[model samples]
Structures are given as structure tokens and as C-alpha cells.
Target: MTRRPATPLPPLEERRRLREAGSLTPDQLAARLGVAIGTVRAWESGRTTPRGRNREAYAKLLAALAESPTRTGAPGSAPAGGPEEPDAAVVAVGPAKTVSGGRRGRAAAKPSAFTQTPPPSSPFLPFLPFSPFSPRVPSWAPPEEEDPLGPVSDLTPVQAFDALYSFCAPSLVRQAYLLTGRRGLARESVERAFQLAWERWPEVARDPDPAGWVRAAAHEWALSPWHRFRPRHRRPEPPLSDASDRALLKVVLRLPPSYRRALLLHDGVGLGLPDTAAETEASTPATAGRLLHARRAIAARLPELSDPRVLHRRLAELASTEPLRTAGPPAARDGCERRARFWTRFALAFVAVLLGTTALSLRTPPAGHEPSVPPGETVRDVPPRVAPGPLSEKQRKLRAKLREELLHGPERLAPQPR
Candidate 1:
């Protein structure tokens, strides 16, 4: 018998090259393909063969190893060829293990880093769209009007008097002076609060009580970085001509931030203790206590100012001269209100059109038949009353046969007895 020429083996040659270069271990190659180490050894020794996808995987693995130092052996490593050594000699060098088919563990599990997550509901939250940071878009509609109660929110040491002075106008200047004991501080605080409201107009609109939000924002602003550096008193302050007003200022200024805040809320601005507490994020009882203490301190500090006539005359004079800042030019005041009204009208018109279109569609008669009932009638609400047409030839024939049989049989006998 003639012996065939020995077949050339490419896979066995590549496997032997990889081992010589130290790109992969025998156990690693076997584990990657979920095969026993003996199978990889056999392929390298040229005693058995790698088939189909295994051959493809082996080619890819070698290519990946050759290209990257991070993946394979470090840079300047040995190449995979050493043809002079026999394949059988390589297998003999390693220890043997008996193979068993069983469950695989942690080492064999595939990595799972590619999972996805659910996205948040609203793109805008905690931060609103129309904050001070948002760009201003000009509208042909109008200028934004200040809300009547807008000035009522957070009043800092300076702002408390400002809201009273500014809202009350020139007439209430003395009353405002009485409240702050410093007219200049009061005016500045009022102006700052207005600017604050303008900056956060969009957020303010969304708030349940815009005035409350403005008040809270103003309070935070008072404790802000800018406030800390500014001198307690500045030049060109408003003049408090009344001696009692001058004296009252000294007494109020001596109190702590909390006590002063409580007094300002109750007497100057007319906010009750509970409302003040809510705005300040304090309990009602605590706010009440603070208010009581603040009042007592003021009375003790200025016995003359505490008298009914002295205090009343000052506030009354201020009220008379100073009109509340709530009134402004009609054009300037209608900006936001006009925009709101326009959008509301647009929405109502859109809904009406939609409803009309739907009604028309429902009432439309189908082609090839006249409507059972005409449009713009009560019949639209009720179902169409269908009239029965004449029967077909087959039905007519069956009805005729049944009628003849009934008349010739039972009915015919009953008629004879009558």
C-alpha cells in the first residue's frame, strides 16, 4: 500500500508559535473557547485538529495579541515562530490533568458593563427655565407689571424699610423712616428687592405665592456675600427729621437679627406672626415669642415714640404722602398679564376649533348614501332608524312555501270548525 504525503497543518503551526512567544497560556486559550486544556494541547502537538469557528477564533486571538502590548506580552516581546522543535517535544514538558465535564464558575462568567438606565422625567426641575440666567426674549406685547403685593416678600435689614418706603411712596417716607429709623437703608433695600424679583420673574410666576418666593429669595440675598462686605451705614442716607424717628432707629438697631426681623414684620409691614414664621421658616410659636420680645424692647427703648399719638402721626403722615408702588403706567404694568391673556385666548380658540372639527367629522355623511337625518338637527344624538327593503327571490320563495303549508294543514282544519 502507498502511504499518502503528510498533510501540512496551519492551525497546529500557529498554536505552537503562540506558546513559544508567550502571548497566551494553554489553560487561557482553552478557557476562552470553553474547551478542555487537552484539546488545545492536542492542536499544538499536531495529534488532533481545530475545526470551523475554533480555527477562526484562534486566528483572531493571535492577531489581537500581536497588535497591542496592553493586551498581550509587553512591548519588544518575542515573535511566535520556532519551527525547528518537534510538536511532541512541547507537550511532554507540561503536567497532565484528567478532564471532567461539570458546571463552570466565576472565571467563566462574561462581563456585563453594557446595561442601560432609565432617564429622569422632566428635563427642567430644581432649576427653572426662566431664571435670571435665562436670556431675555423681547415681546411686542408689553412691559411686565409689578404685582401689587410683590414688595411684601423677604426684607433684609435695609430692604424692610425700602419696601415700606418705596411701596408707600414719598408720603410714607416718614412712616418708613419710623420703621427703619434710617430712611436711606429702607429705600435701598426696597430697590434691591424689586431688582431681585425682576431677575427671577419666571420662577416667581410658577410659585404658589410669588410674593412668598420673592420674600424668601430676598432673605437669602441679605445674608449673601455682597451684604457682608458693605458698610452698615452709607452716605447720602434719607434724613429722618422727626426726633422720635431718630430716637426709634437707635432702639431697633440694638436688637439681634431675629428680634429686629420679628418687629419689622409685625409693626412696619403688617404681616402676622404666623405668616412671618412661614416666610422665615420658623414655627408660629417661636415667631410669636420673637414678636413679643421685639415689641417690648422697642417700647422700653423709646418711651416717647411708643405713645399712641407720636407713632400714629408719623405713620399717618408717611401713608398720606407716599402712595403704594402698586400703581404704575398702564402700559408698563400690562406686560406679563397681556402675554398670559394672549396665550389663554389662543388655547381656548384652539380647543374650540378642535371640538368643532371633531363634531363635523362625526356628523359627516358617508359617500353613496344620503344621511338618514340632516345636519344641525336633534337626530345627530339618536341612532338612525333604518327602513327594511323588499326581500330577495330566495327569501320570498321560502316564505311563500311556508305560508301555503300552514294554510293547507292546521289552520285549514281550525277554519272548518269555526
Candidate 2:
């Protein structure tokens, strides 16, 4: 049977962009394509190239997405892919209601005070063709002036990541510093966290709290015991200028790790009790206990800072005073890509080693199976003989002598019946 040729696909990077433009997640695309989500990931990441039917289907889907521009807003507005059409694009919605042609309708149609003119074309609406006399785009429309809290989700993957990093990095770095008492470690932790977030950007982007996701990762990295063995982390950073701040930090560090974490998340970060508990992966009561125990430990050493309010204020001051900063988003992204490539190469080398071992085994001659022989002697045949015939002459003579002796001996040794 003749097989149909697979459809040609675009560049690996473009495949991902098309999917993102369509706002279709890997899971959504996988479901549509009847393939595992990992397979979709491999295809997009260039780990595995699709073939046969899968290649055709995936290429077709991405081609459709590429053809349909995601930026266009509505039906009447000019399609983003096409050129501007001022006259054809006019969309006057909600026009006045027409009356039936009758005398009563004509009388009813008469203008009343309640009657209003049709709403003027909205200046914000993209469909409107305006004059040079019309007001220029507002100053607030600049990208930098965009409302940080407003939804800016219709973006390419990289742009969305930059927005997230810009929004979350400053506070995240400070939080990492508070977790680890070193500014350098804090900066490294936040930077590494962003690298990890970029590495798993799709999952991070879909998360409900992307900031929290990065925060958890940064805190984990900052608090890692492995950091103690590193040459850089073995030595402590320079102390804070304020003696009281140093003392407070020392008392905090002295607390059990869990308790210190709870205190920081709850009091320092201003997270709600439940949120602190969730982030710390403990129950509400357990987190409260840790938090209380930490606070009490601090109070023991520094009674003057006993009040929760005072402690919270002091902790915030200490965290804020640290000179922790993160690398730019683009730099972080490039580093993440480099790290990913390194691991990918490492894995390929490992697999190649395994395959080489298998090939070597196949080429080598196998040992033959040999049965073991015991150390005990082996009896080999010498001759077959009839043993009884040779002794017959000597046996007859002895038998006759023995009969005579037996008769004599009975007579000599026993009393006769007579």
C-alpha cells in the first residue's frame, strides 16, 4: 500500500508560538490531537519530531492557528492580519427602532423628549475611522503606563513571562533574603527561581498564583541545607548596620527551621494565616503552633520586640533593608535555556553510553555452558569375571576336612546321650 506523505511543519519555535497565539494549552492541544501531553511537549520543544498521521494533524492545526491572528478584537473591527478599511469597517450598532408604515405608527414615531440620538462612535473602539482632528491616542495608552493589575494576557509567551517577572521579582528577592540571612544567597535564590520558572513557563503561567509559585521555589532554594557546604555560602555576608536588626535576625535563625519559616511567611510577608499554612505545607493549627513557638522564642531573647505588631514591623524593615536584586528577565530566560541545553546534552550522552554498552555486549563472544565434575575418583571398567569357578578345588578339600573335624569335636566336647 502506498503511504501518504507527512505534512511539512514550521520551525520548532514557531510551533509553540502558534499554539500560544491560539491560547490552546498543551493539554488542550493533546486532547485535540489524540496524543499524550508529553508527546505534544516533545514536539514543541524539539525533543521528538512527529511523523505520519500525527505530523500531518499537528502541522495542520498550527497552520490554522498561524492564519488566524489572535490580536483582533471583534467582528466589525478590522481583522488584525488584513489591511485597514475605514469605510467598510464602520459598525453603527443599536440604531433607532423603525415603526410600521401606518397613521398610528407615524403619530407614535413623533419625537418625544425621551427620544435620544444614537450613541456616538466610541473613541476607544478600534473600528472607528477618525480624522486628524480627532483626539490623539491618550498618554495613558503607553505600554509602561498600563495598569499592572489589569489583565494583559493576550501576549506571546516571552512577553507574558517578562510581565510576570517585572511584577514579582523585587518582592521575591527580598523574601528570599528574609528566608536566608544572606543578600547574595537571596539574589541567587530569586534568580535561580526565575530560571526554573522560565524552564517550566507553561505550567507556571497556568498556575493561579505564579508569584507564589516562584516564592515557594526561591524559599526552598534559599533554605536548602546543601548551601552550607558551598564555599561561597560557608561564610556569612556582612552584618546589617543596626545592632537590633542583627539581634532580631539571630533570634529568628535560632528558632527551629519550620517555626522560623512560619513566622516569616505569616508576620513578615503579611500573608494570611491560612495562606502561610498552605505555602508552608502544614495545617492551619500546625502552622499556628510553629508561628507561636517562633514568636515566643524571639520574645525570650528580645522581649522589647515581643508584640506581634512590633515584630512584624521589625521583620519587614530587616527584609527591606537587604540589597537583594534579580537579573533582568531576558537574561534569566537565556540562562534557563542554557541550563536546559546542558541537561539535554547530559541525558543524550547517558543514553549513548547505555546503547554503546548494549552494542559491545552483542559483539562479544558468549561463554559456553560447562557441566561440573566432582573431585571424587571415577571407576572405569577393567574386566568382567566369573569369580566362583576358580575357588572350587580348594573349597572342596576344606569342606571335607571341616566335616571330619566337626564329627570328632562334638564327640570330644559334649557328654554322650548313651
Clash number for every model? 10, 0
Per-residue error for 201 in candidate 2, Å, reads: 1.4
- lDDT tens readout by residue for model 2, 1-418: 5333335566543565466546676799999999998788667544366877887788789878767744222243355575332110011101112335532223223321111111234222211111111212221122232331123334567766776676567767766666777888878888899899988887887665566788889888888889888998878688988787789878887877678788877766545566778898999999989988888888999997788756764665566555566789899899999999999999999999999999999989668867789688754432344575655666668667667765644445567696
- The lDDT of model 2 is 0.63
Give the Å shift of residue 256 in candidate 2. Answer: 1.7
| Overall lDDT per candidate, in order of appearance | 0.44, 0.63
Q: Which candidate is the best by lDDT?
A: 2
RMSD of candidates 1 onward, in order: 41.7, 26.1
Misplaced by over 4 Å in model 1 are 1-185, 215-228, 231-239, 304-418
